[model samples]
Target: MSFDEMDVESIWMDGEFVEWDEAQIHVLTHGLHYGTGVFEGIRCYDTAKGPAIFRWDEHIERLYDSAKPYDMEIPYDKEELTEATLELIRREGLESCYIRPIAYYGYGMLGLNPSDCDEEVAIAAWPWGAYLGEDALENGVDVAISSWRKYASSQIPTNAKTTGTYINSVLASLEAESNGYVEAIVLNKEGNVAEGPGENLFIVRDGELYTPGLAESILDGITRQSVIEIAEDLGYTVHDDATISRGELYTADELFFTGTAAEVTPIRSVDDNQIGSGTKGPITDQIQTKFFEIVEEQPEEYEHWFMPVEQ
Candidate 1:
């Protein structure tokens, strides 16, 4: 849904709540021009207790980690940001929503160096359903191998979710849409399966789970980590350092992408080749089932994964 149509009316910015329409930034914002900023995409699910954020602490930590490579420090501590986000959600009266916390170089000097510019932070929440589509979660999505290659670690800090790096993702995802596909799968410099435009890649073969490691220039996604832990706990062996080749996509038994936004979506076809059964595989179903059970159901054993919001 569009932001205007959503129920959100207020945004937490710089320690104060501002009307959604009033949270404006200047045109000359340093991050806008230079793309030197860090951000996080978080999801708050409507649990029986209230709206609780999934893995809130881990996501907050990653936001700070993302800013480190650029030497940009978020002026506020984690507590301040977390409290602000929760309050913003409460104010919106949202049962479920996507939360975006961004720290950017705001209006000031236009030079390449952002040290002279102001560091501004804002937390905005809006109602969003599936990122790809609701059907993608159940029916799976058609993917294509993008001609664009993922940036190598030697070229830039791939681990950081910097605003500039997403330009590459934008290009790849656009390519997929133009080619009549739902999403794009990017390869690393060495032609290894890196990840999707904004999510991590995972393949299931022979009842095992495998994904590209940290060295593959793929972002260490929190959801990706959660799935790995979940799979292991469910008695499946996970291989973290699987340098999958381009041809592997065509032959993998089952494949899926994981992210805060994508969640656990199955890939039915790649480049027009059908995956196992041409649908979500058994292993993918099991993992996805367990993931939602924890996120949406809030079972006691996985309680630590959620940060309950008291209404």
Candidate 2:
């Protein structure tokens, strides 16, 4: 869904707020031409205390981490980026919205080498409902095993959320949508289950939970880390590293996806095979419930994960 002009009027560009429609880069921007950039999708929730950003420091750290490989130096320090993001959210008066922090190479030299290009950063926040669909949160979504294989870390830094690498994701996701499924479950170069387009995959069987590790060409998602912790806290053994075959998904007791956008979305079916009971399973509900509690209510125990922003 596109944001209305009224929904997001102000955008933080480099250290100043500008009209949302005015935040633009030259057509020859290096990142636009060659896709040399890094970005982070963070969520701010309307918790009881106020509008708090989830894993604020972690996202900022990852933002820097994402830029490191490209040799892109974000001019501003982490503190500046963090403050800019918070101020942008406050300025927009958005209580619950998706926050995007992107650092890209700006126009300078049109040559293939972006080493001499300038690193530009911007932050924007606006209300975005469930990424898949509103019903997808509870009823779950059907996804196809994309013909597109995730690039190996050796080919590119799959661990980093580089913008260029997402072309592979785009192809996979487009294939799924064109084929009528809600999303795509992409496999890695080695034919092992990697993850969804923008989310990590978790499989449940025998009451134990499992997800592919960084070795599987999957991102080190903060939400994935939270789900592992929440599941373990509930006395469930969660394996951070697991080699999941495409066939394993069809027979799993329950399957779900985790990420900043998807949150805790259950996967009801893959290739039309009903996963478990074909609805959100017991363990999935338990984990999702606890995860939501932390984000929405700002539970006292998990307060450290949230950074409160003055509304």
Per-model CA lDDT versus the true structure: 0.92, 0.91
Model 1 global lDDT (CA atoms, 0 to 1): 0.92
Lowest lDDT 10-mer window, candidate 2?
1-10
Look at candidate 2 and give me any clashing residue pairs.
none
Clashing pairs in 1: none
Q: After superposition, how far is residue 6 of candidate 1 from its true place, in Å?
A: 1.2
Model 2's alpha-carbon lDDT is 0.91
Residue 7, candidate 1: Cα error in Å is 1.7
TM-score of 1: 0.98
lDDT of 1 by residue, 208-246 (tens): 999999999999999999999999999999998889998
Query: In model 2, which regions exceed 4 Å deviation?
Result: none
